[model samples]
Target: MGRELLNFKMFLSVLFAFTVGYAIITYGRLVREEIGRYDRALSERVQVIERVKAKPITVKGLYLTASSAASSRTRQRIIELIKETELNSVIIDIKDYTGNILYDSDLDLVNQLDTERVVMREVKEIINEFHNADIYVVARQTVFQDPALAQAQPEWAITTEGGGLWRDYKGLSWVDPTKPEVWQYNFAVAREASKLGFDEINFDYVRFPSDGNIRTAVYANLEGSKAETMRKFFKTLDESLQRSRVYTSLDLFGMVLESGDFDLNIGQTLAVALDTVDYICPMTYPSHYPTGHLGLANPADHPYIVVSNGLKKSQTAFAKAERTQLRPWVQAFNLGAVYDGPKIRAQITAIEEADRTSGWMLWNASNNYDSRGLLPDEHAAALRSDVTT
Candidate 1:
């Protein structure tokens, strides 16, 4: 009987030892998982902090196309003109309204176009030269409405009701913004531009196809509101750019100033976009406005009044928001308006006259600018007299 009791006691001892071993193993796994979860949460929090601190260097610039005046002699003259005009900045078109890329883009599909004849091979050298002159370089990339990319990746392009790639008045098809893959493609391009040493990456046509068949167009994914999709695109680009430490800016329609309506079906909201970008350039070109705005007919004819009032409204709207800069794209092109040096001066003065803090960039499609028009006799005289004094 004593021997039987001894055997039972040994069995209980063995059972207790097994239970203790199991408890230790389970507790160790739980502790390891808890540590892993904490580590992931901490890593994500650090990333967020890093993004909030990202900012762009400030600049005052002019819009220029390297390919517009590709001749070496013209490029030299432009360099001299830029220095003479006291313009220390240039927004060169890396891409344009058309699907053509100005530089040699290694983007697998862009290479197949065989349109390499149109590129400015010395783009990197020119950019470096501009940097040497204390000039800021802004690489302008047009997104969303790339017919070139659409032709290459039709599966990624937006389609119309008739089951064809949607065409705008210019006969160009756009990449559907609703598709995240489309956003990824464009953002990848922007990232590459940033890596190439562009001081800032200015995304244009970052919205939906404005001139396309709006009514019949069908998004491949049809995910969210236009504004929401735009926000997602902007946020994705913004985050991607954060690691590169490059500044980002976007061009918004002038109408965004009046109504504050971002869903003008183009996915542009001033408030939401401004939060993620460094500078917000409202194409406040007076010529683009309707005949009557701010109770003025033919806003383009009166550059001073149009720019002044529009800037004043922008100043008010932006003042209540967070932004690093409020630069405005001034009119340098002849959009059916007789604009001369006096008119250009008026536009500059209007911006200055409003006491708003920002730089002004002149836009001329031909790459030919009337320097005389930009510097009126009065300002010239004032500059000379001040220098002598």
Candidate 2:
């Protein structure tokens, strides 16, 4: 009887062991299958993200300040304008002249420096809204004229002769252009902008300080002439951004187009800029031109002549460039003269008449766009058809 009982116990123990082992094996298989399913789902998600492509359009755009971009009413108005008119693009300020990033940034330095103001908290959503409307979005980033960066990294700033931070005419501090760190910072911003779904990155204030106490400002690391330094910077920017999906553009002074290799001491020349960027956006505001420009007493009064002549000169200057196209920033504000529909249309006509221009962007600091000068959607479509034909 004792032997029989002991045998029964051993049998029971064996059965329990087998049951436990089978359960473990089954759970392992289930876990592996679940993991495989998750991997496939993740891959599909990545593919979907990668499939989103920017719509190609001849960008007739308007500039929006960060504040205006963030405001719902302003944004709606701008969208309505685009839907009603020939405009197909919007340029929002990612980084403005004040050197504050308009949205939250993931960069360690940007965070550490506390430079971001979070003006546009829903930047991605904003971009998506524009995309939904079939509008191309461009991020305008002001380089070098970064007061925030200069304050945070004073060692990298353009210093005054007395060793204080040099201030521009507007009392804005700037980072030294020659510093590699400055280049890397701006590159990182551009990369972030591209990742955020901006179709283009428009870099402004790329040159050395154009206005300020010139004699007192000292650049510690400047090696070559200002023009050469600017050229090198442009080449570096091109190399850094070449593989990026977003297009690149530079905001050049209008005079650069007619300067004939003279850099205006701001390190901007048309030829080099044309070769470096996908688009060269000359600020061709007739109001900004001095008296006697284009043989006119007031260039602002003759918008057609100023724009046509400037663009004509630019076309000649960059006629050989294969990649870059002209997309100028024309005046939309009343600075020197009242710019009504006729004046605005004059500028648009000038751009359309150019031999190689891709488009034009209107600049009004107030973010108030006058749609009278713009063609209706149907008219614009017909115009596009004619051009294509």
Question: Candidate 2's C-alpha lDDT?
Answer: 0.89
**Each candidate structure's count of clashing pairs:** 1, 0
Give lDDT tens digits, candidate 1, residues 107-142. Answer: 764576442235667677777777776677888988
Instruction: Tell me which residue pairs clash in candidate 1.
Output: 341-373
Q: Write down the TM-score for model 1.
A: 0.77
Which candidate wins on lDDT? Answer: 2
Best by TM-score: 2
Alpha carbon lDDT at 334, candidate 2: 93
Superposed Cα deviation of residue 389, candidate 1 (Å) = 11
Write candidate 2's Cα lDDT for 164-224 as tens digits.
9999878999999889989999999898888888999999999998889978889877887
Could you tell me how far off, in angstroms, the CA of residue 239 lies in candidate 2 after the best superposition? 2.3
* TM-score against truth, every candidate: 0.77, 0.90
C-alpha lDDT of residue 333 in model 2 = 94
In model 2, the Cα lDDT at residue 82 comes to 92
